[model samples]
Target: MKSFRRHTESHRTDSIGWLRAAVLGANDGIVSTASLLVGVAAAGASPGTLLVTGVAGLVAGAMSMAAGEYVSVYSQADTEAADLSRERSELEADPVAETRELTAIYVGRGLEPALAQQVATQLMAHDALGAHARDELGISEAFTAKPVQAALASAASFAVGAALPLGIAWLAPAASLMVWVGLTSLLFLALLGAVAARVGGASMAVGAWRVTFWGALAMVITAGVGRLFGAVV
Candidate 1:
């Protein structure tokens, strides 16, 4: 008889960077585009004008998200590179000090001093820079910055999210466009939040409520402002 083995899998923390960018981009796209549509519609703008505004917002928001994500992630990458360079210099100048530093860190993390020294020595022998980078500098390949990936994910997700409200605005009757867009946008926000929370292993209800509340507030505020300005003008 052949023996079978079970493999255990765990959540991937590496997804944190891209997931955060995507979620933020999508949420902003939905809220901003929907709010813009509602605001314009409330101001008695024609259906064609409202649709045009939404389409413009979708395109602008996607571009903004991509550029912002790329810049921010690239900054992080630069910082990490600088830190690694400094660490390499320190290691080259005084390898003994570097080993002691690693040993001290392990000891601080609840290891016996002797065991910590042993572990550090072995780890440094295997891969000095890697061990120090992870243990001392708190940097790892899993969390490394990938600007291109982040930018693409953000732009793509933003476009997809923005399309939902735009589609509703285009199809709904002019008189009822505001209501349809508002309600459907909130629903989309709730779903996005719930799904994001689930994927991140968080409380789905909290995520859903948090996003829905903020989205509602944004639309209400925009609509009120538009109405006030329309009346005044």
Candidate 2:
């Protein structure tokens, strides 16, 4: 049992699909919603309007994220399924040719001709599809995507992210709602960047600054537009 545990640990890859999705989703949720609120508030919109805009932005962003992720992942999933089907057909129709092809793949990878052929023969006899899937297609159980999972994750994270800004509008003073919201949102942005960087094994300073910079720019732009409108009115 201990040996099995150690073996699994050693095989662990630096990346995982769910972890990526979760980090991405949460970050999107926070940054996008915050920016939207800041922009609206800067325009000098009413508190009621800001709240409504925030809610609308959250819902719209969440749905869009989910739909986009679903379509993208579904396309990839379809491609993979097609490849697996074709491989299955090849396995049935002309296995000898397939074996030779697979053997050549092993040989190209650095094994000696005899060793490659022997390994290919044994692997094919055992589970040719799995071997090809790993070596040829680069698809493995660890990396295989789940469209539903990605879609849901992105949507859920967006909503959560948007919620922070919305909450600020509710709790902060209306007279200075934009200022408070902007400050709070930027804080969240920096924190999220740091946390995401940590999770992704990247430099925290770079990550935090990168996300915060975009978010700050977005808010500033929106505020500018709002000021112009407020001035004209």
Model 2 residue pairs with clashes:
29-161, 30-161, 43-226
Identify the runs in model 1 with alpha carbons over 4 angstroms from their true place.
1-10
lDDT at 136, model 1: 90
lDDT against the true structure, each candidate: 0.93, 0.84
TM-score per model over all chains: 0.94, 0.88
lDDT of 2 at 31: 74
Checking candidate 1 for backbone clashes, the offending pairs are none
Count clashes in each candidate, considering only residues at least 3 apart in sequence or on different chains: 0, 3
Q: What's the CA RMSD for each of the models?
A: 2.9, 2.7
